[model samples]
Target: NRADGFASDSVTVLDPAAGTLTFLSEAAKLAVEEFVSRYGEGGKENFIKEHILKNFYAFELMMAPYTVGHLKMSFLLEELGYRLQDDDRFKLYLTNTLEMEELAQTELPGMASLSEESHLAGKVKKEQPVLVILGNPPYSGVSANRGKWIDDLLKKGYTRSDGYKDDGYYQIDRKPLGERNPKWLQDDYVKFVRFAQWKIDQAGEGVLGFITNHGYLDNPTFRGMRQSLLNSFNEIYILDLHGNSLKKEKCPDGSKDENVFDIQQGVAIALFIKKKGEKKDCKVYHSEIWGLREEKKYDWLLKNDIKTTDWRKLSPKSEFYLLVHRDESFLRSYEKYLKITEAFPLNSVGIVTSRDSFVIDSDKEALKRRIRMFRDEKMPDELVKQTFNLKDKSNWKLKVVREKVRKDEHWEDSITKILYRPFDIQWVFYHDNLIERPRKEVMRHMMEENLGLVSVRQVAEGIFNHAFVTDNIIESRVTLSNKGIAFLFPLYLYSDTDKKETGNPNKKRSLGSTMMLFEPKAEYTIKKPNLSPQLVERLTCQYKKTPSPEEIFYYIYAVLYSNIYRTKYAEFLKIDFPKIPFTKDYKLFSKVAEYGKRLVDLHLLKSVELDSPVAKFQGDGDERVEKLRYDGGEKCVYVNRSRYFEGITKEVWEYQIGGYQVCSKWLKDRKGRRLFLDDIKHYCKIVTSLQKTMEIQKVIDNIYPEAEKETIEFENK
Candidate 1:
């Protein structure tokens, strides 16, 4: 009948027209029946049924080949349809399996989930027809697994993976294992690029295109990832976004550009095309601007066409704030400006810490380099102190650090590992007024706990609590934290202008007859009033045998600023400045002035008195200070203060004694190191007040005049 199958199921077939007997012929059937009687004892009907079912079962067992073949055929058809019969056209595979989360659980624990082959099976072909494949892969960073899981996942095929077996592999570990080095894995994007390249090779065609995270371009964590990509793609296009730049519908409010401290991390997108084998040299075009609508032509941008200005160069805007160090023995406000704007430029000012020994903020690359150099530059003495020494870097310090990292510890074990190495050619800002701070630091309350002046607290919270207590917070006051104090120490130290007498090696130490030497304790009070009282007391005890009246004054000030005394002063001794009088009644005036000088000696006060008018009181570091008495006569007072400690008015002291002037003079003079404690405290107070005042003005208009008034008075001019 048909050339396709048996002619009939029930009858013995005979092709009489061709004169040949078929296997189903009557004679052949008789022989088959006899053979069955002799060997196949089972009935023919049962045997036939069993044989047919067995064959069907075998067919089902080999169904994988058919399914796989169908996929291959579909790919071929698609490639042919797309006219990809050539040998060098690019091919793409876009997989959509369980997404990044599921993959982290199944195959790549402790790592970001990535695109898989299931989704891409239909997208890719055995043959290539396109130049490149590229698109934004769906983001899978929002999984519930904390970074702990990612860390473990990174070690899945490495030694560390065994430590975290409970987490297990992702759900889509469908691929066969190969002799690949698991330690080489850096991140999801890296895996994506590598996998895509492998698929391109499978296609026996052109190159690959991948659009993924741009972090590899610069981030330290992605260094290895970057090297891998660099080896693959000759051309790279980077589109950097301000921190937290992703625009997602699920976001409550789209994030804006901000300091790294304000947000977790910065985000960017990248386009990569491999140029491993090519006839023409690869061309690269980079541009940040997208979706441009022009007069006639679509302004599609290439990197070469993009101007340098189009790329963002980060700088602190006028809105940025700077912490200054001025009068503290080692601090000043302008010095702070210099520190941020010049010394430690915004780009270079990585971070500061309250506890210097415990926490260090270093450049990531610098840290790595330092670690390498430190290892290489070791002398025998250095090696003796270490518990263990590495023979080579193959034993990744990451493992060592991880092992040394105490469970839930606050600080890292390696002390030298955390140091920050600044970039060569420290960042210098050519533009003046690069940043304008809207806020200024000021004193919160003066005359609190009978102390004439007190420092302010910052408006924002700090990492570590300030070591000292502060007075009440009014509308405007200076705010300094432990963090600020540590940051401004160098700047403040550079700005001390008061001259100091040093002992000659062969001569006995003696106080110079240079009128009055502001006690080191007083300078300290003026500089860092935030230091703890215990520390101040110890310094005072060491500096002077019987603390001078000024030292006594500073001691009292220190006691008041101590955490134990702040609440007491706030409740019992807090005084409104309005109550203090500036009268010349000798009994009151002498007592007040004596107490004031005592506080200065004790490092409790940051006060400097000036003549009411300028030229009349001018002298060689000396002046006769007069006060109005009840008798209507001028009561003469001796003024033997540092000539640099000038007062603008009876109530307003010049607290912002320029730091650069002081440092330059000190450097040029090259006299023995003289430390002033009061300058440090004064610097802190002035800068804090300046910052607070500026901040208040930013929030409320017309508040600066009043704020400035309080700040000036608190400066104790």
Candidate 2:
């Protein structure tokens, strides 16, 4: 060791034989050698001196003006050391700038080297049977170029024998984003696992362990990453640190809290074993996040049991229900229910371009129209003029006049223009209003399927304030206004009534007992776009399949009316089901339903019909289509309206079998884009069967295989 110093303008390097030498004696060397042998190696370069000297000068030259006092010396020295130890590309340039000040100055490795010396070594020796690899990795993700570097590295590391490539390290930048930049598809901690695994493969004798963002445990974005980990690692330990740790206010008396990590954030720490064939789940011990004093990141883990089960069997929705709708009012009203169950609805307030054109509401045209209309009407005329400065006086003046008189007219045109029709909120029913006439037909209308007629046997006694609108051919609920009455007959009946209307039947209207409401299907009259008739015949060129300009409107008149009637009637299917995945709706399983050979089953519900005389009268063209003759179609159908009584709190498995239908390869050979119905049904059955087995096992354990001898008398006795 040489301890020679140099002045600012000079450079020097002292050979090992120089003055002020410091070396361990022969006896001490033997002791250190024994320790080194145990760890496998020594005699490696103590420091990459040349690399350090280069970066030191470069950092000084660049930061001379900004640095002060010891900051100048420390900054240059650290940069030089980092460049030398990390083997980064900037080392050579840094060395050129440092000019090799003195033997001692150039020998110091960068700040990173002092703390992470062992990790910086590029060499690997497989001396141990297995080593536990572990670390906390940086959690930052940012890049200027679509993460091409990451893609390149991952592609290079792929292999077939270990299923490394198939773990699904694929690019996801093509996915869509909202107004802000898309979150990085992968987090930094997961990246550490990948890098660690790569290094282990090179060494050939290490089991990787790491604590990363808890996101891998739950976020859908990491589905591929999680699958890769599961395939490679045998045992998995997940510590979910999710909760607000800090007080709502920063300090007790308006002062800042000193704890830097106290910011309310969630974290996940995972421990993965590299050796395959171990248990799938591991015993996880969670301490406070970062093991901060008095800060248990997983205090909840202590109070609540940490359950372990087959990773695949775990359900994301099991603990919480999601109601996914854009309607704020619906969400607010349902938020209370979320405490007990998970139920979220899709946004119900939707926009449509026309009755037959499109269904997507966030189209550019729609957004532009909305913003413009909001500006024109919401802001004052003087303010608008000052801001936009009218390009066309006539147009501006017309808008101003409309704003004063008929405000809606100012932007009605823009608001109505769109490529797709919007969702109609009227299609859903709330509990505020309910009336009943026919239920089955209404179901058919809403569901776009035909349901056969079924008699409405009142569960209670009631009389007809007006006639029940039922026919062997067509059925539907007639509006109170259309029935020329103020309310429903509200009839109830016993099972003994004559099949004919003329039996000694109960006539008094009863407000009790379940009464079935059935109505015919609502008819939609698509304005039949005149495309190349050839294109029209192909499903691909039709609605939702083609980019052709046409309208698609699901009229709300029927849905609104039905919802109102259903609100009034206490007779509705009571079963609560989850929202239908891959679609914007939920389902209600009818308690009254029984399988029928032809009609399947009937779920008693109060729903409205598009074919109602009143609905038809208001829309002439639609009415004609509703009444258009069908070849032997049933008059009435069962309606199964989804319930909002409970929140969704269960995870339901949804499997898709067929590809997409809009572009089925069988029909047009558009691979990767189309799906067939066969695929859908097949997948549905498989997923349903799997879920059914789990459910059956639960029932068998709870209800079956247990004897109840409370009433076991023999018939002979």
Candidate 3:
């Protein structure tokens, strides 16, 4: 039998002070005994050294970061009849691969005189032709690989030889990707892939393989990178292992699917092959494996190879050369509709308060107190930070805030009402200097009475049903379950003015103004309909009647909430902002618009229908949510040991907005806080709103088919 080499006990023997040397000695003895028994005692060492140590190239090309790893690797090699010696080749390198550099000067001119790290760097970079590079690079969205060499290489791949440094221009197809924030492309895994690709390209003909985060397979931001890969390689193979926990992915058979690695991000095995001589057009092949972790890793992957595995040939197109399979027919049909941004023509991302704890509060008084303390010149910056529990971040720092606070004149006036979450109103200090990203240009409309549609450009979780109405300033994460920012598309655009006007508070400033002035004498901020005039004219011509902007907004809301629309074009919605399909039939448009208006009223908690809620708060207790759980049989949700909310059905209890389960998330946020009478009533109203939303969605779905049958198509400008 082969010696075990104490492999099973390696973890226990890792501690150097815990007799690790003794364990290694025992393991070595076992290997020697096994070798002596296999051969003769006298010549066993010579035979093992000559045949195994010298011949096994793997033993002469090993690298380990730490002493324990080096010891374990050496122990394993010794068990296989190889032993380390003074004259042996430099294999065990104790160096950071990302930080490795060639030696400036050596004792002698040869590599032998240099350190192991320097020698390995020289060998990999110049001496050896790396035909194959394969490894699982770490996945970090906020990559720490800021080294000059790697960053320069990454920039080189994305840029042309002409040295063009335009804002959005990339080298892939010599066109701009038009991404606002493509920071995800700078992930560590992506950087490593770029590094490996650079190394392989330098060799002329080589293969690069990596099992990394699968986001690049279909993410729109990675389009440039995908095209770059196609331009470099002759053949590319992608084996998508679908197990993204954040998306809650399941096997096709309705069974639980798990990731091979203990990670939330889905992973894919990508192999890029570049052959010698004239390069041909890159051939892309894709496959997906989804099942139990063990079944996928052991049964499927172990049994499959490049030639054995079945792969579907793909012709990656321009704009986005996505590696995953897509329904081309659906994409073509879906592209006919008008995008939300194109319809509204004006939108901005919601406010991003980096110091949410310091700047925002559930209680108005608490926010006022913080602002007062912040404005006080007596209090130290560090003391204020500690009192508010504020940490210094890249965007917001105490010293910078202090400097801005000194010059501020209207600190008290900055406190404003904001929609922190769905149906969750909170107070925030909305000053440009106080808040990290106040988004003043868009928020000014909300500062007064206004309505805005909240949505996300991309949906990474649950569904693309994130559309909501907000009459107040919203947080960046108002619609998103993840770290993504939500955009606010207001119905009316407001412009700043220095012109002061004296008029009655109830009277409107102008004929076009949608809102009346709250104060008797104030600066008149001009407001106009944010709708596109050309699109409105097209809609008016199609219906033979001019539609009001409010009618258009409601019509859009209804279409976005339609179950059929969301399901039919679900794939398209995941990548970009939603598109609204205009119906030629005026009756269908009117009906959907009415339903949408009701939904908006209900969401804003202004509808009289919310007075009589279906769900009721029952039981007598502190009303503090301890461990929220649902009793499916009883149709009740337990907030604490004794208190519970009755009449909440399974569907209502599990209804998701954006990616959050509304009923559960509301309770979860107030886990330790006691629910007041108003809070209890508000929860009931939220439940009713969701229940009505579902009912309205079903109606929209029924009417959506009729609308789609005779739709008005817009020409792309």
Highest-TM-score candidate = 3
Clashes of each: 89, 89, 0
Instruction: List, residue by residue over 1-717, the lDDT tens digit for candidate 3.
Output: 113322211111111111123333443345456556655577655644553333211111122233454566467656755676767531333333444365554554533444645665445554344445656667899977678776656555433222323122143467666566778877878877776666566666667777889998887788878887887778999999989887678886878888988989889999998776536899999999998888665589888898988899988887678898876667765678888988877788888887798888888898887787877889988888789887787766777877787676656666778888888888887777667777877877676556799998877755677889998889998886453678999887666541235222112234344443322123435666777766788887888877777888999999999988888888777777888888889988999899999999999999988889998999986888899989999999999989998989999999988777889988998889999898889999999999988998898888889988877776542
Candidate 2: 10-residue stretch with minimal lDDT? 589-598
- Tell me the spans in candidate 2 whose CA falls farther than 4 Å from its real position: 1-135, 140-145, 152-157, 160-165, 169-184, 207-209, 244-260, 276-411, 416-717
Please state the error at residue 605 of candidate 2 in Å: 17
lDDT of 2 at 101: 26
Q: After superposition, how far is residue 393 of candidate 2 from its true place, in Å?
A: 29
lDDT by residue (58-144, candidate 2, tens digit) is 111222221241233334435433222344422111111112221122223444332122222111111212234444444555622
Per-residue lDDT value at 357 in model 3: 81
* Cα TM-score per model: 0.25, 0.31, 0.80
CA RMSD, predictions in order: 28.3, 23.9, 8.3
lDDT comparing candidate 3 with the true structure: 0.72
**lDDT of all predictions:** 0.27, 0.26, 0.72
User: Candidate order by TM-score, highest to lowest?
Assistant: 3, 2, 1
Better of 2 and 3 by lDDT: 3
**Candidate 2, residue 515: CA error in Å?**
28
Looking at model 3, residue 303 earns an lDDT score of: 86
